[model samples]
Target: MEVWDRALTKRVDPIRYDAETGLKIYREDQLNLGKGGNTPLCPFDCDCCF
Candidate 1:
């Protein structure tokens, strides 16, 4: 699965997962959202607009 890394302003592929826990491993910095600011608005064409 692919997820956007908000801090890095780019996308990244998961490097590996813990087989027993099924947890994905990612860089800590890549997941942090600095200052916890306002949530980003959905794209104009997103289904939520309809």
Candidate 2:
């Protein structure tokens, strides 16, 4: 249905985004997928990406 759907269905890629250039890319990696493993918890004072 969507690119994400295709990626997930295939399940062999890493999704990447570069905020500076607004570029998005995807590739395959068996060890990692989806939001990465551990991310720093959202900080209350941060206005970034909220």
Candidate 3:
């Protein structure tokens, strides 16, 4: 086991860790959802087009 994992296994220690936040974070688990399209939307209703 890795040094980090060994440290985490130390029972009776006050730490917050669960299955959802597992010891390892695989690349697949990380969701990279950026702006779907390059087109950007205006923040407010402007008459720039009109």
Which of the numbered candidates is closest to the native, going by highest TM-score? 1
Poorest 10 consecutive residues by lDDT, candidate 3: 26-35
Report the C-alpha displacement of residue 26, candidate 3, in angstroms.
Answer: 54
Q: Residue 28 of model 2: what lDDT?
A: 36
Order of models, best lDDT first: 1, 2, 3
Best-to-worst TM-score order: 1, 2, 3
Task: Compare candidates 1 and 2 on lDDT and give the better one.
Answer: 1
Cα TM-score of candidate 2:
0.24
- Cα lDDT for residue 8, model 1? 57
Query: Cα lDDT of all candidates, in order?
Result: 0.55, 0.42, 0.30
Residue 3 of model 1, lDDT score: 63
Identify the runs in model 2 with alpha carbons over 4 angstroms from their true place: 1-14, 28-50
Task: Please write out the lDDT profile of model 3 over residues 1-50, one tens digit for every residue.
Answer: 22222223432322434578555332321221231233344323432211
Question: Which pairs clash (backbone N, Cα, C closer than 3 Å) in model 1?
Answer: none
- Stretches of candidate 3 off by over 4 Å are 1-44
Model 2 CA lDDT for position 31:
31
